[model samples]
Target: MECPCCSGKPYEQCCEPLLAGRAAAASPEALMRSRYTAFATSNFDYVWDTTDPKYRDEFSHAANCDWMSSSLFTGLQVLAASDNGKEGTVEFIARFRRGPNPEARHHERSRFRMRKGRWLFCEGDVISG
Candidate 1:
């Protein structure tokens, strides 16, 4: 299956390794892509696990899972990505459709941080939707 992140690679070769715990996302953009794939597949556990612990309480697993499970994720576009050794950022647009509504676009710039040698999503600023 094609990767939901639109990386043009097979799912197994792209995000599966990360989702299955066989590998860690090597960069902020990689983590961002895998998170998109997680949402696309309704793997809510992966989504929650990859979030920075400090920010986890700001979100609710049940709510996020409901949103992801209800939406049909269509595609992802990474507009920009950059990282230093300890911090990173990814600017992206994700497309999805919910219920009978028209396809919607979520544009955001996400932040990430490295902790104990693994990258984790910290937060995101929504640009538009």
Candidate 2:
């Protein structure tokens, strides 16, 4: 299956390894893409695990899973991305639908950092919805 991150690559070659714990994301944008894939595939634990420990408690697993379960993730568009080796940012719009609701765009700029040789999501600023 094509990756939901719109990478135009097979799932296995794209985000699967990241989500499966077989490999780590090579860059911040790659981590962002894989996180979107995790949401799309209901791999909520992966999302939680990949989050920075200091900020992980800021999110509730139940809430995150509930949102993921209720929404049908359709696609992801990375608008801008930058990396400075240790810290990075990715701005993106994730498209999704819930029940009979119209498709919605979740626009955000997410921050990530490299810790212990693995990329971890730090936080995000919601740009629009």
Candidate 3:
């Protein structure tokens, strides 16, 4: 199947390796893309697992899974991304609609940190525009 991140590649060749723990994302942008694909595919566990441990306490796995299952993801647009050694930021807009509700977009600049040679999502600052 095509990658849900809209990376113009097959899922197995794109984000599956990172999501399956077979490889690490080469850059923060890649990790962010994988995370978006995970969401689009309703793989909430990947989303939770890739998060920085410290940030995970704010969420429960079941709750995350439930929330994700409730939405119908449409697309992802990577607005910008930057890497500086151990720290990085990926700005993106993820489009989705909850049930029969109107479609909406979530714009955010998500922060990530490299830990043990793997990128982990840290936090995000929502951008409304």
Clash totals for all models, in order?
Answer: 0, 0, 0
Better of 1 and 2 by lDDT: 1
Query: Please, what are the lDDT tens digits per residue for candidate 1 over residues 1-129?
Result: 899999999999999999999999999999999999999999999999999999999988889989998999998999999999899999999999999999999999999999999999999999953
The model with the greater TM-score, 2 or 3, is 2
What is the lDDT ranking, best to worst? 1, 2, 3
Error of 3 at 110 (Å): 0.4
lDDT for model 1? 0.96
Q: 1-129 in candidate 2: lDDT tens per residue? A: 888889999999999989888999999999999999999988888999999999988998898888999999988999999999999999999999999999999999999999999999999999954
Residue-by-residue lDDT tens digits, candidate 3, 53-88: 989997788876876889888899998999998999
Each model's lDDT: 0.96, 0.94, 0.90
- What is the Å distance of residue 81 in model 1 from its true position? 0.2
Which residue pairs collide, candidate 1? none
TM-score of 2: 0.97
Q: Between 2 and 3, whose lDDT is larger?
A: 2
Stretches of model 2 off by over 4 angstroms after superposition: none
